[model samples]
Target: MAGYATRVKADIARWREAGLIDPATAEALTRDVAANERASLSFGSILAMMAALLFGAAILIFVAANWEAIPRLARVVALFAVIAAGYVGGAVMKTRDHAAIGEALWIVAAAAFGGSIALIGQIYHLSGDEASALVTWCAGAALAAVALRSNPLTVAAVGIADAWLFLKGFDFFGRAEFLHFFIVMAIVLFAVSFWTRSQASRHLIILSVLFYLVLLVGDYDTLRIAVPLLIGSALLFAAAVFAGDPIDRILQLGGRLPLHALLGFLTGIAMIQFELADESTYASGFAVASIVALSGIVAAIMLAGRESRGLRWLAYAGFAFELAIIYSVTLQSMLDTAGFFLAAALLLGILALVIIRVEKRMRAAAHTGAAA
Candidate 1:
């Protein structure tokens, strides 16, 4: 028995020396491990669980009891009481290492309940404008998340607040100024996410960028210099694809599809203008071919990369735009138009077959690698 005890002690000593445990913590852990091996439950863990249950029940009872006549002061007091109870329960659970009962979950639930109570008060005639009421509710939620270190709820509150601001601003002013306000708000959210490490906030930023891109494209006809504007927009999309990660790649690629369609429409306009300006037929043909060739090359490169599904759609869009250009340049003569359509159909069919073959080979390689 003495020899067995000495061996166990030596093993523990080595663990401490290896920095797997701090000396003080190791002593406590060793005692806990021994107790656990004997199938014991710690008092602190039981107490923390009981506290959480009690507080949760208290919140329910308080709301139910005062559902009709809950005074403003009482609501505020209840909110603070819930927040304090949550912190204490969290601290107790942390000390006992009862991580299964998540602190963040309790905190967020409590905050949501408190916010609902406050919102109810507002609905019943506790004074505030729609903006102020929304801001207050979101602010309370944000505070709870920060206090409890809950990233998910913090992000949710941020998103709600941003949407509220955008809607209110648009309703008051109009769509024209809302675009600028949304961009500013998106930048602020992105900055906040960097510090908070909130994935939800990052997603909201992506959505904001997409919304702005759509707004810009819808208003493209307002621009006086259409060709230069189209080129700049295309360049911005290309830059976004190169500079952004996968998510940005998807957004930019989708945004660029509509731009391509717009390009085809604009191409018809340019043709009419050039014809009126007395441009030579050769010069016009060269210009049209150059635009089609450039767009097709870009699309092919994007499709080959296969980083996004949107890129594939954009590739198809480019092909459609190119066909439209070909039709316009040849529409004056029927035989030439038919020939151009036939050539395009053949090219698309071949491209589709090549893509399928490449995808099949990739799948086979992946399976082989996994098996190995």
Candidate 2:
């Protein structure tokens, strides 16, 4: 069968080199043919499967025997024991390096066994306080991850532990006192972000910032506090814009700006709701002015950096937002919401024409330069 498969591959390669098949088509065919060969297992694969079965049975029996009196520490110890045994068995069987289907199955089995042990402990009320237990479990899992060089499991454990900590900290206490905790969490997340270069850690940091915003601004009736948040959000957006990579820049910038906008919009609505317009009007005006100013700054940066699409989007969003505010103010005076529809149509038409003319000029310049 191996010889037959090799011959088939050779024939395909010949056809590819002869220009009888496109490169992508040939590559796809090669992958399809290779897929079947990977399914075939050897003696080592069978041994790995048997070891996995025995390990699973041992874990099940251990859990069943201790079903009535297993303390949290005992359950933890038993789980570690199973993991250690599995690692040793895999190491001894020399099946660790096998790249076959059965090896993958056994690896999955090991992971499942570990996860099941943790779940069983939780089910039996042996996991203790959620925060403490999660921390302990995450620490253990992290150690195992380092030892086994398993990144996915490490990330999973870290995420679970962090989530548990956040929930525990946030629910019991409001954001005022929780500021310190969130800061610490952010530092930890930042460290993890750099260490693993994982997007999840970065996202966690962003979330921490959002939580900080809520804590700081949720109950405030003052602009002094809110203005700083708007500034911080603007700075964050600016940093994202100036980032080296386009995709990362967009993601980071996009994530923070919407929150900034939402917070600003909601704060405006809240001020209206509470009739705190006298104090809030100044803040609202300041925020709008700041947004307009920042929009131009971002546009300038984008244009200077030759980022056409990003600049265009930023400019359009800024324009639309300002126009919406104008329409809203007019609607309040006219008591006619239908007027906003006309204003929107006019704004959109003007924007569309401007964009088209700009694009046409750009194209014309490009063509002229090319001809030159």
Candidate 3:
């Protein structure tokens, strides 16, 4: 949005030169664009992310290797030292306007929290279960994110939460159920995303959820996983398409969740379709795929994609990919189903052209009426 607004500001300057607007209007436009630019992430955020990853890796490797010269207690104490130094340094840097460095240090502190959990657990010869330690680390990160409003820490919290669920969710409550933990962690991560108002954190949350679901697929059958994914896509598509204005307004910061969820779900379903390419299921899959694909494109354009460039492009790609899959599966059926797909694409193309023409005419009529 900042980039687009900046380009529009440049266009406005050109328009001012062309006498399309006055100097005052140009200045006002430039100010609005500048404000939009302020809404974007700073170079510091990117720098902090990079620094956190680099330093965090270094800390993990050192701890994971366990230098025998340093006693286990000393090693654990050193990790705690890092935690204190990082947080204290981050607080001082924050006060000194070194926000990026502060954030990076905070990330280091949070990561050290996790490392400390592991080291402390090992020192005590605690139960080998990983979930408890992960939860403790996640709790620390989550507390820091909320207290400091740190986006990177929120992402780390989400990652920790996802890992904990993936590793021990099945047997956590002695119930051996995965969905329970998934549901709980999802609520926490999503709440953090909104609270932080960080686009990167939100996308990281999506990536975490996608990772969990794909991992679930690894542990289960393709069709069983595909069924839930397809169902989820249908739900998102339906809500995106038919939801009222109030609901759409509430989804303003959802970014690409609706669109990408559809992508993940449909892609999984497509994989299943390829695996189970039988006559009965193939025909049904084709019908389901076409409907979901078309509906997804329309919903993306009208609801999610209108405001999001990434989602719009992803929708276009998904639609095109679905067409390819449909064509591939139908080619063996004597070109009958393939022909249907081609004809449908042709019809949709014609309809799009017609809509464009109508929109152009309507704009022209509006301009004429304004002049009159």
lDDT top scorer: 3
CA deviation > 4 Å runs, candidate 1 = 1-66, 86-127, 139-149, 169-180, 212-372
In terms of TM-score, which candidate is stronger, 1 or 2? 2
- For candidate 2, lDDT tens digit of each residue in 1-372? 355568879988999999999989989888888887534456876776566556566655655565457676666666656566655654454354543333333354455454555556656656455455455555555554445544333454456555654665566423234334545645554554444434554555555555555555544654555556556555544554455356455344333443343334333333332333233333455334534443443444333334344444545565555556544444444543355446445755676687679989999999999999
Off by over 4 Å in 2: 1-67, 70-76, 83-150, 169-176, 215-226, 246-336, 339-345
lDDT at residue 46 of model 2 (Cα atoms): 70
Clashing pairs in 2: none
Query: How do the candidates rank by TM-score, highest first?
Result: 3, 2, 1
Estimated TM-score for each candidate: 0.45, 0.50, 0.79
How far is 196's C-alpha from truth in model 2 (Å)? 3.0
List model 1 lDDT by residue over 1-372, tens digit each: 334345666678899999987899778866765664523335764565466556555665655555557676666665666566655665676568665355543543555455555545653666655555555656665665556555555675666666665565556534343345556655655555655556566655555554444344344542343455446545654554455456344443323443343343334334333333344433555345535554444554543335444445545565565556655656566786786567656765677788789989999999999999
State the RMSD for candidate 1: 14.6
What's model 2's TM-score?
A: 0.50
Give the winner by TM-score. Answer: 3
Instruction: Give the higher-TM-score candidate: 1 or 3.
Output: 3
Which stretches in model 3 have alpha-carbon errors above 4 Å? 18-21, 39-48, 165-176, 210-258, 261-285, 298-307
